[model samples]
Target: MLYFDHSASTPIHPAVLKLMQDTELNHFGNPSSAHQFGQKSRLVIEIARKQMAQAIGCLSSEIIFTGGGTEANNLVLWNLLHQQKKHVITSAIEHPSVLNVLKQLKEFGVTFTIIPVDHACRVNPEDIQNAITKNTGLISIMFANNEVGTVQPIERIGKIAEQHGIPFHSDAVQILGKIPINISDQKITMVSFSAHKFYGPKGVGVLYLKKGTNPKSLVIGGGQERNLRAGTENTSCIAGLGLASELANKNIAKRKTHLEQLADQFKLEMTDAYPEIIYNGHPEHSLPGVISATFPAVTSNILIIKLDLQGIAVSSGSACSSGSVNTSHVLRAMNMSNDHNIRTLRISFGRDNSKEDVHLLTEKISEILKQHHNKR
Candidate 1:
């Protein structure tokens, strides 16, 4: 497949895969165990954790490894509103993992105010500030949108939360490697990340909780991940994540330029070919690798299938909702429907993609557009 779905998940790099294999063979001891094997495993895990922290410019202890972004997001939401009748502020465009947890948690008197986005699929921090109440306990906004690729003003929102003495969290799974992240400067106390979002193995995620910023534990078992996340650690995956982070630190600059150039080329070509295509997300403030656009009278899912049949993979919505053709909740919540809703497709560029791939995909898309128009 052409694989234009890096935002959904990136393919594992050779270095990362090799590291994971080596770790599986050598670091088989449990992190909790105190024997020589256990010490060796713990040492490796700690070194990996340090590398991950350095990748994001944070301290090693601040990084809490979880199953993936979904679990990391769950860890924050569930712990904050566990037994309280507290108020939460979120955006309408959060991933299903974030939205579903918040939706289900509302059953126990946990109140929420979701800030709506504009047609560009961006939430205004002012709206969040307006929604804050005396009972407000948490503000959970994503750093970058999963579907539309809109990067939010996390610093501004973080400031708002700080002024009100409420804890702020962000699901940074989509933008972790694409952008420079320093949780210290933002009002964010909790941030979620995933290894698969970069060129690392799946099933390993990171949660950065600032020092002295402790939330209630989500998993209850052995004291792994400093009691924030409990369970025997996936040593291999953790090792893979460390290796990926190290590689990302070294290669992010080059990858950023390549992905951004590809996206710009895509916008120029696709827009010239189909002027009726509607852009989604912040035109300038979105992630460099994600491009969400809608072509009139054409459903994004149809294009996805045609592209897939031609070995060009894409997504209509978030990967969490694998087979649903439902309108993107991010757009629907913005009060648009019909063509605007159904025609949107997410084109995610990656480090491995090239200008030739973009050209070829656009060519295929043009053919599909012509066929679609002729049928109409």
Candidate 2:
């Protein structure tokens, strides 16, 4: 199958898979144990921590490994809520992990200010600044949107948060491998990552907390992850995440150029073939390899199925909310028309995809639309 769902998850790189398998087979000791085997495992985890930290330009001590991106986001939101921060600030287009957690926090008398995005699904830093109040203790915004691939003005938002003395957090899961991210330069207080988004094994993620930023632990019972995250580390997955991060950091420039070419080619070909196609996200400031488009007179669900039948994989929305009956919250927040929302499809590329792959995708999609029209 020609996979075009990199935003949902990426196939593990061969090197990363090999490292994970080797570690799992030979290193089975609990990281908390004091025995030689445990120490070896612990060392591996720390090394991985350093690797992740280096990738994002943060201190090794600042990296807290979590089960996945959802948990990392939960940890940050939960901690802020626990601190009795009565007000929080976030964008309307955050991942469900952040938006849903904020929804649950309303039970504790926490008020939220959701800044809406523009028609291109780009957040306004000025709006974020104006939303801050004395009770607003934290601001959570995504670095780049998952579905539409719109990159936020994170540096400007970070500066606003700094001026207001509120902690700033970004869900950087999609940005980690596709673009270069240095937490130091962005002035972001905390960031979340998922390994599977960047060709690493699933089940491992990282939360980068800058120095002097403290969040209460979400899990209890163990002293792992500096007591910020509990339970013995998933050693193999952590190792894989480290190797993946290193590879991503080393080759980001090349990968960005390649993916950009493929995404542009796909858009040019598809739009030329189908004039009714409407592109989503910011025209110039979007992610390199991800694109969303609306196909007129077609429901995305049916179109996705047709594409899948033709051996091309794409997504109607976020993988986390695939089966849900509701429309995309991201699209809804962007003020997309109901008809266009139903017709939206998110197509993401990766290192494995090439110009030829994009050509095939465009051809198949054109055929599918024609078939769909003929039947209608």
Candidate 3:
């Protein structure tokens, strides 16, 4: 089957899988132990930490491994609240992991302002600045939206937060391996990333907390991750993640330019078939791998099933909550019509995809829309 859902999750890279297998076979020991076996595992985990930190241009001391991006995000938000209780500013288009945690933080005497997105599914930095009162403590925005593929001007927003003295964090899972990142440039106090999003082993993630930022730890146990995360390191997964990060750092530019060409080809073909197709998200600032679009009059779920029957795999939106009846919160924030929400499809390319794959998908999508036009 043709997999066009890379944004949801990627196939584990062969190199990463090989490293993980090696770790499990040869370094299967509790990293907390001081014995030779455990010592070997601990050293491997430390090297992985340095690799992840280097990928983001941060110090090794700033990297904290977590179960995944969700936990990393929660750790940042919870700790920032611990530092001080105040209002938070987050975009309406954030992943549910951040929004859900923000929802829970309401009970902790912390209020929040959910900034709305424009037609391109981008949050206005001005709106964020306007939403901040004297009491705003933090501002959290995703670096790249998962469903819509909009890349926010995070560094711009970060500058705003800097002037206001508010801690700023970004959920960088979607953008980690796809874009060039300099966490220092954004003045980002905390950044969350998942290895699975970048073709690495799953259940491994990193949280970058800037030096001297001092976000408190939520999980308390034996000293690990320099007391930020208090659990035994997953040496195998960490090794896999380091390999993936290194590969991504080396291959980002070529992958980005190639994927953009593929995405453009797909969009152009599909648009020729359905002239009324509406492209969601910012055209220029979007990730090269993702193309979100809506076909007139036809619900995406129905069209997707038709494509799947023809051996194509795509998604209606975020994999986390796709099968549900609700519209995407990102689309809703843009105040798009119900048809825009219902007809939306997110087809994301990956390292394995090619222009030929796009051509086949385009032909299949054309057939589906043509059949619908005839029915009407």
Candidate 4:
């Protein structure tokens, strides 16, 4: 099958798989134990931490491993809200992991302001700044949007948050392996990551917290993960994540160029064949491999099923909310018309996809659209 759903989850890299298998076979001890086996496991976890820190340009102590991106995002929001019931500013197009957590904070007297995006789903840094108030304690914007692939002006927003003394947090899960990340230079205080999004094993994620910033622990038990997250560490997955991060750091340029070429080819082909196609997201300031296209008069759900039947896997929206009847919140936030929003589909490329794969996908999509038009 031609998989065009890398934004949801990527296939694990062979090297990352090997690292996990090797770690699982040799390091089976609890990291909390003082035995030699346990010490070995602890060392493996620390090495992985260091590797991740190096990749993201942060200190090893600043990186906290969590279950996944959702937990990482939750931990940050929970900590900020628990500290004070102040207002938080976030873009309307954030992943549900961030938006849903913010929604739950209303019960705790924590108010939030959602800054809207433009037609291309790009959040304006000025809008974020204008939304900030004296009561605003945190600004949580995504580094890059998942569904539409619009890259936010995170550095600009981060600077604004710094000037206001508000902690800036970004959901960087989608951008981690797709672009070069230098968190230190971005003025961002915290960022969330999921290993599975970057060709690593699932169930492992990272929350990068700047030094001198301590968020309250969400999990409290054994003194694991510097007492921030409690429980025995998943040694194998952590090691795999480390290897994946290293590989991503090393091969980002090459992979990015490849994906961009394929994405461009696919769009050109689709637009050439179907003049009515409406492209979503910022055309110039988006991720390399991701595209959201709206096919007029076509239901995204029906198109997705038809594409799947043709051995082409794609998504109608964010995977987390794929099958939901609700319209895409991202598209709605962009002020997109109800018709275009309902007809949108998200196609994300990955390292494994080729130009030929794009050709096949576009050809199949053309055929499907033709069939739909004939029926009409």
Worst lDDT run of 10 residues, candidate 3, spans 77-86
Per-residue C-alpha lDDT of model 1 across residues 198-303, encoded as one tens digit per residue:
8899999998998898787877887788888778899999989998888876767777888889988988998998888877778888888798888878888789
Candidate 3: global Cα-lDDT?
A: 0.88
Evaluate model 4: give its TM-score. 0.98
Give the winner by lDDT: 3 or 4.
Answer: 4
lDDT of 3 by residue, 215-303 (tens): 66788888888787888888999999988887888878999999899998987887776778888899888888798888887899888
Candidate 2 Cα RMSD after full superposition onto the native fold (Å) = 1.0
Q: Give every collision pair in model 3.
A: none
Q: How many residue pairs clash in each candidate?
A: 0, 0, 0, 0
Higher-TM-score candidate of 2 and 3: 2
Each model's Cα RMSD: 1.4, 1.0, 1.3, 1.1
Query: Candidate order by lDDT, highest to lowest?
Result: 2, 4, 3, 1
TM-score of 3: 0.97
User: What's the CA error at residue 291 for candidate 4, in Å?
Assistant: 0.7
Candidate 4 wrongly placed segments (more than 4 Å): none
TM-scores, all candidates, are 0.96, 0.98, 0.97, 0.98
Tens-digit lDDT track of model 4 for 229-270 = 988899999999988888888878998899899988988999
